[model samples]
Target: MDVAEILSHHILDHHWGYSLGGVELPITTHTVTLLSVSVIMLIGLYWISKGGASTLKRLLTAGAEEYVTFIRDGMVLPNMGTEGKSFLPYFCTLFLFILLTNLAGLIPNMKTATSNISVNAALALCSGGLIVYCGLKFHGIIGFLKGFIPSGTPGWLVPLIFPLEVISLIIKVCVLALRLFANMLAGHMVLISLLLMIFIIGQLSAVAGVGAAIPAMGLEIFMTCLELLVAFLQAYVFTLLTAIFAGSVIHTH
Candidate 1:
């Protein structure tokens, strides 16, 4: 099989359908990975909550606290201020869920759900909905609509600027979805391409393939380490952007 096909198998969502009477249920690899991520988060939180006397448990709890603090002080509060406190659970959950999903793909033979645009779009929609809700909740319907128009635009200019502002709002959320999807998907594809080269070269000459293995393996390790950093970075960026966007509508200052 070509490298593209191999990459697709690892990155694309695989679906299985079951029919009972006329009803059909479809479960995809993304479904599995998302569920797995959820379970891991639940278990991690439970472990942290049900504290143990062991050193490992203490370290784990400490790390979890740091994550929460970082998201609160670093991402949420800075963007949304006191209004953000209510959404801490959501932003924290988003970060952890995406972090686990990205990290899961690094595991041998496991799929990354966020690699799918649909999954990321679903997440984007959730954040977008919250943004709109917050705008309306604080400003009321007319005020929320007015927020789209800049405070200083002239009447004739507003007609043009208003649509652009709405479009910009939409593009921001779209970026949230695409940013994570592209980063995770591209990182994995680069890794696969590097590894694939060793095998492709192997087909030419056994000795040449062996020669290729050293650099390919080395690059693969380096890429994996880089991807590990990216996994965390993408999660942080998504949460930070979400907070900023939500903050925009919440404060409008």
Candidate 2:
């Protein structure tokens, strides 16, 4: 089934309305779901703060700290260097936001915001715009444009390579947006289809349906774990790519 149909089937809508300016607004099921996730994350932070260096609390905090440090040291610093430290806050927020959004979907009755293209595109635009802004700030407009064309290309190739380079640059942003959207959307669709299959089989015969359900339930559990990994991996990939893009502009090859 198509993503829209699948999402519409599962994503409960709270309400719809027109704004004062006549813009349509959807109070999506996922929005409320995300509010709860935000509260949970905040509570986690509070727990860490209040645990006061207890062994379990320290372990939880250490795990969280390690993940953050890994992203900074292994992903961001390698590409953007010491100057990359300045961008850490933005990248960290992006990672946590997407991670939480992905995790929210695993909960019963919750919609995945990352499954929505608009949401993923907004994130891509935010990251891409930051790259462009940093590029411009680091190397004036002329320099930023010049950074697009690879050094040592023949003069004749400049005419072709320049436009190709620009297109490639734009494609990077498009890929970033589509990758996360497609992954989340596809995962949810698979889950829904699996569930539907179990229901269909169960209606045919109780025994057979239960038999079908066992494997499907197992797969769903596996996918849930996979989704958690994807959540962190995608965030890392996005931030790492952004750092690489920004680095390329700052220190053009």
Candidate 3:
């Protein structure tokens, strides 16, 4: 294939080799990757919660426990405060699930679930629901609605400010979804493009391909490492923002 065709393949969605219902509802490679990752995560959870006498068992479990402790102490407790302690499990699950999915994309032949806008949107919806629920629980429905009103505002501005605040709240949730989805999608795209260049150059001329492959492949490896860090960073950013949103609404100070 030519360079354009090779690059195009990277940009397009990949399909499963075969369809279950004759294409009525085709399960794509992404779906299978997501399912596989989910199963591995569930197995990890079992090991995380279980105990064994072997040293390897203890070491693995310790790492998982440390991760849980770190998120609870570092993210949830700090942002949510003491009153929000009960929400630790919720945030922990969110962090780990997103982290796993993000890392899954780096695995050979695996797709990143978080890179899908639909998946990210669903996660944002859940966070938004929690924000609203916490706000209403801490303050009554009327009080929560009134929280949007700025202090010492003239009666004339109340009407305008109220609608604006409502819109802002919805936008906040949308930003959350887009932030995760965009980052994950863009990172993978860059990596794919970088790797595709080597193949494209080589197809045109063997010598040029070999020469281009050296730097191209080197850069691809560097980007892969950077992407790994981004995977963790993006997951942490999403969870941190979710906690902050909920905390702000719950306390309102």
Candidate 4:
């Protein structure tokens, strides 16, 4: 069996059809999953904000708001400070969108969108853009550019340090993208490899396949549970780091 081909079937984008946009583009599985996640989040936000009248509805809404509150109180306020309150919605949306997409992968026959580097990079770009915006908003263009150089730096070192700082900013975004994509991809790869072993061994001998099945299934189950936790953890980590980075820029000297 071609292991690489199997992995790509699961990991790579599966195009369902071509969309006639400004240019023809293949609409892939991730596109549908992401759009679904977006719709769900919007409906959830409306339900949370509307404050449904029924007792059941109210309880469910409260539970939903608790997660949103965690982002606001736990992540944003502590890291980004009260000044970051205005952007609470953006952070909340980011966390929830990621959490949903991550969780979706656990469903049978479904895949995680965040496993795609392009998707993760797009997310990082959004966060990076926000960081740049915060810098420009709080400090003017001159002040923002000057913030890269430290207060007591020597004149000669200023030029060297400035370029490094700019490069550092770009690297931060790349890191965010790579971190999420790699983490998600790694977990799924492990899980996929475990299951594939059963099929590969089965071809050699029935008895061997049966023996491998027990351990392979056990590991797959364990990985699934671990992946569930990872889904939430990755979402939180990305959101928290973004807030911290934004906070740093906002409070820069």
Whose TM-score is greatest here? 4
Candidate numbers sorted by lDDT from highest down: 1, 4, 3, 2
Give the alpha carbon lDDT tens digit for every residue of 1-253 in model 1. 4877987876778776767787776677788888888987898799787989899999998898898999999998999889889899999999988889999999986888888899899999999998999898889999999999878789989989989999999999999999999999999899999989999999999899999999999999999999999999998899899999999999984
**True-vs-predicted CA distance for residue 97, candidate 2, Å:** 1.0
* Model 1 vs. true fold: TM: 0.94
Candidate 4 TM-score over all chains jointly: 0.95
Tens-place lDDT digits, model 3, residues 117-202: 88889989999998999888889899899888877889999999999989998999999999999898898888888877777788
On TM-score, the stronger of 3 and 4 is: 4
lDDT per residue as tens, model 2, 1-253:
2445654677434454546577666566766766777787788767875756578988988877887798799877888888778888787777777888888888787888887777788889998898888889888899888988888999999999999988987889988989988888888777777777787788889899999999999988887788778877777777788778877766776
TM-score of 2: 0.83
Most lDDT-accurate candidate:
1
Stretches > 4 Å off in candidate 1: 17-24
lDDT, candidate 2, at 69: 94
lDDT of 2 at 206: 88
Error of 2 at 171 (Å): 0.7
Q: Rate the local accuracy (lDDT) of all candidates.
A: 0.90, 0.79, 0.84, 0.89
